[model samples]
Target: MLLVKILKFNSALLTFLLFTSPIQANEFWGLESWMNSLKTPDFTKIKDVNQRKQAFFEYLLPEINKQNEKIVQLRHALKTDNINSFKLQKIYNRYRVKEGDIDTLLMRVDIIPASLILAQGAYESNWGRSRFAKYYHNFFGLWCFEKGCGIVPLKRDKAATHEVAKFSSLDKSVEYYMRSINRNSAYATLRKIRKNKRDKQAHITGLALAEGLENYAEIGYEYVETVQSIIRYNKLSQYDYKS
Candidate 1:
């Protein structure tokens, strides 16, 4: 009876360990490898617009999906007190900030996918080659005219020095990018559409959001149309949806 009881206890503990192990341990490793593969390249050589768009979507969409799934699983593991699962979940959680920012903004307003934001970062900053991006962490081409705002890149302004906004870290840069769209005057229409969608309990749509960002680029209405084209041709709007 003593031996049988010891055997049963051991079996139960093994079962617990197996069941509590992280669900996506292999997947988490895969994600890290994938992220590391994305070495910044010379954007000038990537002159084909279609190719650039494809590369952007291919690189970004999977990361977003993986992070989103990890966030959900981590919340579940935390609730269940699965210590092993929690440890694995924490690895995935590191990427959740970027994913959560996308999810939260989508919940509030019809906005572009986090992939698009990454693409814009790649495009505007010339794949992290620009002086502002390399030194100041200005990922989104944000300009700052006020004193003590940011570093003034020599090539930024033709007539005089133009300050490029800086951030303490990459995460802060991403946060500022999101806030710039959600709160800035140029994006007022986008904010209103998002507010209207939330009030009505509607899913945020990218095309609708694009209409409001007409002034986002110097080309005004043309820029809006171009963004919509990028969304459609690449089927990027699919990333905007949550399941």
Candidate 2:
């Protein structure tokens, strides 16, 4: 009886591994070279508004997909019992969760839907034409506090210490933006919405998650409404999971 149960457990583990490995492998296959060759296009040079918007989205989609793919891989790793202890510890530290607390790590390590990312990027950066976006690759309007850390806002009060955060590349900006959304207390509601959607097997739409971002801007709920409006007007939902 013991031998039979052991064989069954082994078979189930093998089946699980077989089912998941291919999907994760395909997500990463051939992506590194393509990502390496990518360059940020000069969206500011496009005169037509429609053409510029199209160019901006095109430039951003691949990097967004790449970042989401990495998040998905991390989530998958966390679900397995045999995950490397070193890698798991790194994930816990990176997400600022207690070590061995897989539930919180899972919530913090998940993907931000492409639609939300795109809408926020467009709304914040004026469709990639803002000085921060053009000069610093900071499409999400992230701020940094250390002196000389980033560009100071022209309109910032003399007493204000925060400066708009700069990034070495658009990818870095997206990475930090996603990390902020996942780990920040301000977006705890957003993470809850995402986790609820996952539990229900629902398509995690940007419009739905946008509701949790009322505090993202000083304008409160108005900011959430504007983000949702951007998603609707631009049809950014098409980039998100359909089912």
Candidate 3:
């Protein structure tokens, strides 16, 4: 009887391990681990423009989906006024990227790295601490002059000091950000590059997208360089993939 009991205990332990091992493996990899597996492009070594473009788009899609889902959940939590949910959702919404707009942008232009975009949003909004970001859901630091759309900041400047835009909710803010990039003439170069990538069935690269936003910063050309530096130094673009 004692021998039989020992055999039964061993069988149960083996069954438990069998059921739990796969789950453990999946959890071990996680999202960050999967993202790290993507091949990093050595700009110096990769001379083929077409190949580079293709790689950029492929890498960007998964990251875009991840950020978009977070924004969606965050918007839902805010609308419901669930404070606990809001706290959790805030992390995702803090660096939002619109899904539909990204798809449209990619369809019309080349792919942009989702991580780079999110990093820019985080920086612009000061990690969601900026007045516009906290009160208006303006995650991208976009300024609006028109009435009925945004609020005017207390401090006014010649360029955009008084011109802060507001949103009714997080979704609207994300929508506006997408529209700003897609419709604005300044981003036309970006749109065109996207179109070319789509035509050739290629991926988007953060390096390429940086070129289109030559005017994104107050510092002119230097702003573009800064974003690139952030992406490279921190390896931010590596997050633009799935696990």
Candidate 4:
């Protein structure tokens, strides 16, 4: 009976591993290997637009899904019945800076569409081949004024001290990217558009929401247009579905 009990425990452990690994270990090769695979030009040069879009989405979908899981878990922690629990209060305290109040924060916790972020990241990082992405995993061109925030841009204006933000890991960069769009005043229009879409539909498409990013870059409307064009030309809207 002892041998049988040990066998049962091993079976249960295997089941648990299968269930948990997909969510936590989506990178089949490991983080650095996964990052290197995305930087390969072979995936970027796929002639078919949908094929190329799929390649990019495949590289990022696991990371995006993981961040959204954390956001959802935090939002669930604030549920009316759970808000006062010690576990939830800890979560709330951690995210209080990113989310001002629970209600307002829930509105911002939703995921940005894979297609929209993909287009923007591709534009910013040159398909992960940019020097910034190479050195810093700074795919979004996000800036921080803190003295040691990240890499200092060579062409930063003589009077400007903003450093391009660096991330310790690629997923950390993606997490910060989503949070910046969600909470930053500069992307209020995008968040508003996203909130409205969430109210109307169970799932929001990236193409519909790209309009609200009109001010995302120095080029303003032109940048929004370029993102939309990338989405349109690449048929990236197909990847907007979460499941």
Q: Please give the distance, in angstroms, between residue 17's alpha carbon in candidate 2 and its true position after superposition.
A: 45
Give model 3's TM-score versus the native structure.
0.51
lDDT of 1 by residue, 126-231 (tens): 6555755544556578877786567767655577655778664454565567656754667778767766775787866666677877777788888777667656
* Per-residue lDDT value at 4 in model 4: 63
Whole-model Cα lDDT per candidate? 0.57, 0.83, 0.54, 0.71
- Per-residue lDDT value at 101 in model 2: 86
- What are the models' TM-scores? 0.52, 0.82, 0.51, 0.72
Stretch of 10 with least lDDT, candidate 1 = 31-40
- Best-matching candidate per TM-score: 2
lDDT of 3 by residue, 1-243 (tens): 985686576557546765777656434333223222222233234457556444543433454554555544544554465547445444333334343343442332222466557556556764444656555556577876576445676666657534677554454555556546655677777777756655676665666677777767678778677777766765667665322
Candidate 1 residue-wise lDDT at 141: 84
Q: Which stretches of candidate 1 lie over 4 Å from their true place?
A: 1-112, 115-119, 126-131, 156-161, 241-243
Instruction: List residue ranges in candidate 4 displaced over 4 A.
Output: 1-55, 83-100
Question: Candidate 4's C-alpha lDDT?
Answer: 0.71
Model 4 alpha-carbon miss at residue 29, Å: 22
The number of clashing residue pairs in model 4 is: 0
What is the alpha-carbon lDDT of model 1 when measured against the actual structure? Answer: 0.57
Best-fitting candidate, scored by lDDT: 2
